[model samples]
Target: MLKPYQVYNTHSLSLCYNDYLLLQLLLCFWSSLFSLCLSLARNTKKILYLLQVAHKNSSMAKSICFCLQKLVFFILLSAIVSHARPPQVLPRQEPSYLKFVFNATDLPSEDYYDYIVVGGGTAGCPLAASLSHTFRVLLLERGGIAYGKANLMTQDGFLSTLVEVNAFDSPAQAFTSEDGVPNARGRVLGGSSAINAGFYSRADMDFYKNSGINWDLKLVNESYDWVERAIVFRPELKNWQSAVRDGLLEAGVDPYNGFSLDHIPGTKIGGSTFDSFGRRHSAADLLLYARAANIRVGVYASVERVLLASTTPFSGSRQSAIGVVFRDSNGRYHHAMVRRHGEVILSAGAIGSPQLLLLSGVGPRPQLSAWGIPVARHSPYVGQFLYDNPRNGISIVPSIPLEHSLIQVVGITEDGAYIEAASNIIPFASPARSVFIHTPSSPLYLTVATLMEKIVGPVSSGSLRLGSLDVRVNPIIRFNYFNNPVDVRRCVNGTRKLAGVLRSRSMEDFKFRDWFGNRDFRFVGPALPVNQTDEDQMADFCRRTVSTIWHYHGGCVVGKVVDGDFMVMGMNGLRVVDGSVFGVSPGTNPQATLMMMGRYVGMKIIRDRLRYS
Candidate 1:
C-alpha cells in the first residue's frame, strides 16, 4: 500500500493536470470562435440566413453549432467566476489642478471676480473650466473634494459611498420625498457624477430640437468630444453583463447596435467613466483643462443667498444680482462680488437651484411672506414643475457567483422605456452577531443583481417648497409617480419585458433548479407577477415599488423661470445654466449632456463677450 501523504500528493497533482488541459482547450476554442464571429459580423445577413437554414434542417451541423456555442459561453463564464472579486488596493493619484483649489475658510472676508459660479458640481466644474480660459472665475462648492476618498474613487466602492451619509459633511446627502420614497444626492465636488453608475450617453436628437435654448450643433459635438477624451472609456463586458445583453436581444429589443455612446433605440454598450483598472474619473477632473491662474475653486463654501441690488434708483426697477453671501466651514461669512458687466451664474443642480432662488425671495409673493422672507422678485414658477423618473425593478441572487458590475449595457425600447442592470455585493449581519453584543461576528455578504427600467419623459410632475430656514436642510418635495395613465402603461409594458428577459435562454444558467426539475430565479426581493398580462397587477407593482434613479430635473425651467438664453426672467446679471433649466430630462443619463452643457454655455458666453467687446 502507498503511504498516506504520498497518496494525497498524487491525487492533487492529477487534478491540477486535468484542470490545466481543460483550460488550454477552452482558450483554443474561444480564440477560433472569436475569429469566426468577427467574419460573420462583416456580413450579418449571411450569418442570419445560415442560422435560419440550420434551424429548419435540424441536421448534424445544427447540433455541432449549438454545442460549440454553449462551450464558448461556458468558457467565458468560468473566467468571470474565477476573477469575480476586484482588487482591494488600487493606486490613487491626485489631479494636478489641486494646486488651484483651496479651503473656503482660507478665503478673504470679501473678494471680487469677473464671474461667480455657485455649486462646483457636474455643470459648475466644466463651466468654470471653460470660462477660465478667457476670464476670471470663482467656483464655490458646498462640499469637500472627491479625490483621495477611496469609496468615491473605485468602481467596487460605488454602493458603499452612497450609503455613507450623515447629518452633515458626508459625501452623499440623504432625503425622502413626500411620496415616501428614500433618495440621496451628491454632496461632493463632482456632484452626482462622482457617485453615479458612470454610464455616459449623449442626449437624444429630440432633446436638442425641442429644448428652448438655441444650441450650436457643431459646438455641441466639439464639447462632447472634449469631455470624452478626458474621462470616458469603453467598458469590458463580463459574464453577467454579456448574459444581460444576450437576454435583451432574445426578448426582441432588436438590432444590437454594439458599443456606442449615442442614445439609440436598441441594445448597446455605453461608455463609462471608470477606466480599465477600475478607477473612476468624475466631472471634477474637467478642471484639468482650465487655466489654473484664471480660476479659483473653494471647497466647503456654502452660498446663503444671491445679493441683489436695484439697477436704478426708482422703486420697481429691475434688480440685478451684484454679489453673493456665503459661509465657510468655520462659520465665517464672506462676500463674493462680481465686477462691472460681470455675471452671477447658478449651476446648483435642479434641487439646489430652485431652493436657493426661493430662499432669495424669488418665489410666489404669498409663500415668501409666510416664510418671513422679503420678496426680491415675484417669480411664481421658481419652485414648480419638479419631476423625478420613477425606477422599478427586481433583484435576484444568481445560482453561480457573479462579478460586481455597474450600468454598462442599456436596452432602449422603442416604446419609451430604458432597461439597465447592476450587480453589487452588500454586507449584512450574520445570525451569530447579536444586537446587544459589542464584539463583531465574522463578515458576511450577499451578492444581488438587478434588472431595472425607467420610463422616458414622464408626463407626471409635482412641486417643491421650503422646509427649513437652514440652507443645508433638504427641501420639501414630491414627484407624484405614475399619476398619469400613460406612465403606468409604460411601466406595465416594461415589467412584462423584464419577465421575458428572465425567461430567455441566455438566463437559463442563472436560474435555480428545484427538486421537481422546474428552473426558477431566486429573487432577492419581489419577483415579477406570474400573470404579466394583468395590467392592474403590473401597475400596482409599479406604484408600490417606485423609486428614484436620481435623474430629477425642472424647477428653474426654460420659458417660465429662465429664458432661452438661460437668463433669469426679469432679473439682470443672473443666469441658471444647469439641469434646472431643462424642460425635460435628456437621454437615458443626463451627466453626459449636463457636462456638455457646461462647456457649451461657457463657450457661448466667451463668444458673446468677445463680439461685443
Candidate 2:
C-alpha cells in the first residue's frame, strides 16, 4: 500500500532499530558483568588483607584456621585448571631415521635388522648412527627423547631432578649403592652424558697405554675431534669459578693450560656439553651423521635379551648372536632378527651392558645356573672388575655470595686425584630446613661453594650382580670405595690438597667458612683442630664422606670379557662398546672416553666386518 521509497525507508528503519536494541542489550550486560567482577575483586582484596592481618596479629592456630578456606579454594582452582587442560602436544618435524614409539602398535611390522644396538645412550646413539652408514641399524632406547624435558633445561632443575622423589621414574634413573652412595644414570637417549655435569675432556694419553688394547691412537684423536665438534664447548668461567682457577694456580697446580679439551695435569678450563647459550647438546645429536634411510631409532624400546643362533662362522663351537628381543612402551614384546654377516652390539653402559649379558645367559656359568637361567656362554668375567670413581668434597658458605658454576677449574694432583670446585647461585637450603621462607620485600639467598676431589685410578673395585630377571629393576652395585688402604690414603690426601687450595689468597678473599644446618660458621677442614696432626680427623672424614662421582666403569673388561676389538671372546656377532668394556677407568669424567670407545668400536666394525669380513 506504500510507495517504493517509503517501503525502502521503512525496512531500513526496522533494521536500524533492531541493531540499536541489540547494541543496548549488549552494553547493559557488559556493564552489569563488569560491576560484578569489580565487586568480586574488591572482596577478594579485602579477604586477602584480612587474612594477612590475622596471620600477623593472631596465634598460629587461629591464623591457620582463618586462611584454611582461602588455601582450599586456591588448591581446588589449581587442580581444576590442571586436570581441565589438555596435554601439551609437541610439534614435530617428520624425522627420517627417528621414530617415537608410544606403544608396540607404533613399531614397524618387519622384525629384521642388519645391526641391533641396545641402549640408545651416549655410546649407543653414536655407534648406531655410525654403523647405519653402511648397514640397516636398529637403535632401541628405553626412555623417551630429551628435547622437551623442562626439568633438564633450567638452571636449578638438575638438583630437582636428582633429589625429587616424584622424578624417580624420570629418564634419569637414580639409585643408591649398597654402601649408601647416591648415584644416577640416564635412562634417556644420551645416557649419563645427558644427565652429567657436562664436562667433556679426552682421557690422558696414559689411559690408552694402560688400557692394554692396541688402540689406534691416531683414530682416537680423530674420534675426539668428531665428538668435540658436535657437543663440546669452552665454558665461560664466572666469578667463583675464576677465583677457584686462581686458587688452583696459586696452590702449585702449575702450567696453566687455557681453555683446552686436552686432559693435562694443571689448572685448565675444560669443555662442557652445553653450548654458549647453556643448551645441552647430547650425544643423540650425533645421529644426524647417519643416513636416515639406513637407521631406525625407537624410543621406549627396552631390549630384553640378545637372540643367539647355533651356527657360528667365526667360532665353530660357540653360538652366534643373530637377533634381539625387546619390550615396547606398551609392554608388548617383539623380536628383531639380524641379517647375514650382521652383528648385535651391546652399548648399554657399564651396569646395563653387564646386566643385559647376564640376563641373556652369557655371564658366569655358576651364577646363571643358580638363577635357573640357561647359560649361552661361560663368560666368567661378565660382571667382575667393576670400579667407580669416588669423590669427597667439602661445602662452604662464604661471607660473600658465590656465582653458579659447573666443573670449571680442576687441579690434577700428583697423588692421583682430580680436584675441582662448583657453586650454586640460589639459596643453599640446608637439609634440615622444614620450609624455605621467602618474602617479596626482602628475598633471602645463600651460596654454597663446594670443593670436590675425585680419586683418579682408584684401587678399590666391586661387582654388579643381577638383582632380578626383570629389566625394569636396577642392578645391585657394590662399589667398595675407600676399601683399599691406598684408596683411603689418596682420598685423604686429595681432601687435604683441596683444603690447601681454599687456604690460598684468592679463596681467603671471600672468607670461606663451613655451613652448619642453619648457620654459617668458620670451620675449615685443614684449620679444624687448629693444630698439627689433624690427619686422623681428615682420614675419618674421607672414609665416611667418600661417594661416587658416578663415573662407573669395567664389568666387561676388554681383555677379559671382550677382545681387543670389543668383541665377546667366546661368542660371535656380539660386541660391547660401552664403559663396561673399559680395561680400566680413564681416571677422568668418563663421558668423553665412553663416547670415544663407541666411535672406535664402530669404526673397527666398519673396517673389520663391514668392509673386509
Clashes (N, CA, C under 3 Å) per candidate: 0, 0
**What are the candidates' C-alpha RMSDs?**
15.1, 16.2
Error of 1 at 487 (Å): 0.7
Q: Give a tens-digit lDDT track for model 2, residues 512-580.
A: 222222222233232323331477887777777777788888999988999887889888889888888
Instruction: Give each model's whole-structure lDDT.
Output: 0.83, 0.72
Clashing pairs in model 1, backbone N/Cα/C closer than 3 A: none
Model 1, span 55-78: residue lDDT tens = 767674566476555555544443
lDDT of 2 at 257: 88
Please provide TM-scores, in order, for all candidate models, with all chains considered together.
Answer: 0.84, 0.79
Clashing pairs in 2: none
- Single out the weakest 10-residue window by summed lDDT for candidate 1: 6-15
Q: How close is candidate 1 to the true structure, as a TM-score?
A: 0.84
lDDT of 2: 0.72
